[model samples]
Target: MSVEVRAVPGESLSFPGRITRVAPPRTHWAPVYRRRVVVADVVAVVGSTLFAYALRFGNAHAHPVQALLLLGLVPVAWLAALFVFRAYERRFMGLGNEEYDRVLQASVFTLALVGTTSWAFQLEIARGYVIIALPLGMFTILLLRYAMRKWLHGQRDRGLHMQSLLVVGHRQGVLAMVRQISRASYHGMRVVGVCLPPAADGRLGVEERALAALGVPVLGGLDEAADVSVSAGVDAVAVLPTPEVDGAFLRRLGWALEETHADLFVAPAVTEVVGPRVAIRPVCGLPLLHLERPELTGFRRLVKGTFDRVASGVGVLVLAPVLVGIALAIKADSRGPVFFRQERVGLEGRTFGMLKFRSMVVDAEARLRDLAASSEGNAVLFKMKDDPRVTRVGRVLRRLSLDELPQLFNVLLGHMSLVGPRPPLAREVAVYGDDARRKLLVKPGLTGLWQINGRSDLDWDESVRLDLRYVENWSFGFDFMILWKTLGAVVRSRGAY
Candidate 1:
């Protein structure tokens, strides 16, 4: 492939093609490498299934014929579901938690299919075998994928197996494209240079300076893009849109790249639409992108809510003894009720009394006025890293997060969630600006971004940012991730007390 190199005013030799290269600071790899990683995942799933069977059912007592049949059936069913689900598509293979999610989904679907088929045919499949194999196999496959991802990240960190890209677009588009590619280095792309299309003004925009800060070279204006690509040795050219460029210019740019043997990528202006939600249609030489919203209502919400309640209820039951111990400790250390109830905003701006084990003295609120002047809390809230109101046992409760256990009841009562934005106090909610009010759009959580991030350490702005991001990106999978991280955060207790 061709690439172009150009020297900017103060930057070193700019190989715009080097943006696509796997070296030094850039960690993104070629698209082909990502495809191979998916293939590796398929192999891992098969291998993990076999290993799970061998581990669960020892070779001594295992029925060889039954085992062999199951081994063949498992991989075939998994591969079928994965293919039907389009789980191995290149766009989703490299980054995000979606890859792991698909693997789990495919496994669950395969097991359900197997169960239904066994019952329909009256095949007398051993219940114990099915039970042991499904979960064990699923766990093994997920662990394997996690291990593979870690290795891939390590490779990216070492700057191997990356693609060199040439960004061709208006100044703003080029700057945005470069910034995105740079932030996602694990995707394996390096932008070596940019070719800004010709403008009526003949002067590049301030975004060009932004790109220069990223160290990407600016090849001459758009007309010289193909020549620059050839000299710079870039593998791909990413075409970013500008108001100045119409369909005819884009067509010509495509033809130029084709003659140079460089792969062409067109970035659409659409945002917030994920891969699964988008479909492309080509009609009359025009490419139309069809965006479909994921179904998040009716039965889906019911299922999610039911799962949350059932899971949280079981958790409360399992931790009952620990809860009792914490309550007793709080009582012994201070003269107050076991639980503290405060009015906090819930989903859709509804107010509810959030419950937590009292982690401070009985007169904590009465003393708030005295401590306000010396508060270490964020701008919109009052806090103290070393508040005098906190009891001896309260510190321990805060550190291990045992203080929030009583909120499990709130979750069961449908007033809170096992995961969501932290419930805001009445005063905090009252002062929330228009943008910050978005956090009230979802059900408040016992432990959320604010909880796992820093409980009380995050500034008001950072806390609000995390809350809004959680709302905008809410998904069942995301909730599970936050729950998992909450466990780690609780153990570490960083910035908790």
Candidate 2:
């Protein structure tokens, strides 16, 4: 089930698992998925245009013939805009915000095209028709694309339409890559085999036996990676950064993979740095990775702050009735104050009083010491599924995450953001390491990656990782996506005790 892989020099790498059988390569997925997207886009655009035509002109309108002509032109132009924006490209058909981002761009472009063309040609395009059709078509396209993405993910979860991946690197690097790929099936990468550097002894060692346990096949040595990928029928080859994988080796590997259908990917040693921050630059035929510093201040921060305050202000007003009802329920359920305020660490390690609905008994703080030992939470976080201090109403509120609603006021008061890292308790901050403290670079959030990912179910390491990822990759679009998903998480109530 396994073969000895030569250990590269410098530090010894080990994989404490066994190798498994590699699946037959599946390369037909991208083309089929791209076709589905194209059909969906056309349907969405055409359907929205027809609906708008009916709503605006009706059957008896005198401009019915003209409207029909305009309708045909709009869909054609819309699809062309989408194509021009690279929305239909294979790279953008499946995952990431890039797909949605491109769709939005295409929508804006289509709007511009319609307006400019009508203005230049002096065509009698109805203002009402233009307004209705553009917005409806944009919304429909986004909706259908989202549905298609969900379907693709569901198929991937069932091990269908996955790219068979061959990992080439030292044992430890290979193991980390494989483990990460396994956790996020939505990425559509299925690790089939690995190629490691030649071991010094040329004999199966403890690491080899360990890798044998995990069942990912050890195909061959590093030098044979390209051949192994081709022979094993892999869709892609991921080469982890190591001393053994120099620029020359990578160049050769790239040239080698050009003959096969498999794509070559070189993973940088730096982890958790992606999106806009990392960019590849080629200087004199050498590829250089440039990482931009996180924008924690200046114009972006000002914009985010303004948005947080405005959104929270409107949110509080909109939810006034619900908030009042919750306050009354809490007063009737327990002998405590309607609101709970706890000192939490915020931006730059400053202390702020976070607001929440009172979800526990009057003496809950006093009883913490007694239940600390039985907490089900990970290190630094104290949580209990069935604590005696929780009032009956408190449990219901917590389950629905209604208890955190008052934090909107915190957000309005500039104490937190609508989306960012979770506000850590002062006690938790006391024990935070350098990496964990990096989360303090930005304002804490009412809901964040931690909230939607698993909430209380995630361990300290996982919670910190998610928080760090959010802090490092904060964007308006990312924040909006998190806010949207938070609604689903709240409804599911999976880890919300």
Best by lDDT: 2
Deviation in angstroms for 102 in model 1? Answer: 4.6
For 1-497, candidate 1 gives per-residue lDDT tens digits of 33344343554442343334322332234455556655665676677666666666666555665666577876788778876776676555656777777877888898889889878887656666677667766676567666766677668767666667988877766776787677557676788777886545545457766776788777667776666666666777887766756687777777766765467787777543444567888878888887675544578667767987998899889999999988888888889799999998898888999888999989999999988899887898887878899999988888888888898888898998888888888889888899799778778887787877777777787788778767666677778889887997899797787
TM-score of predicted structure 1: 0.63
Per-candidate Cα lDDT values, in order, are 0.74, 0.84
Residue 489, candidate 1: C-alpha displacement in angstroms: 3.5
Cα lDDT tens digits for candidate 2, 230-261: 66767889999888898899888888778777
- Global fold similarity of model 2 (TM-score): 0.86
Q: What is the C-alpha RMSD of each candidate to the true structure, in Å?
A: 6.8, 4.2
Candidate 1 runs further than 4 Å off? 1-94, 101-136, 148-297, 366-378, 449-462, 492-497
Question: If scored against the real structure, what TM-score would every candidate get?
Answer: 0.63, 0.86
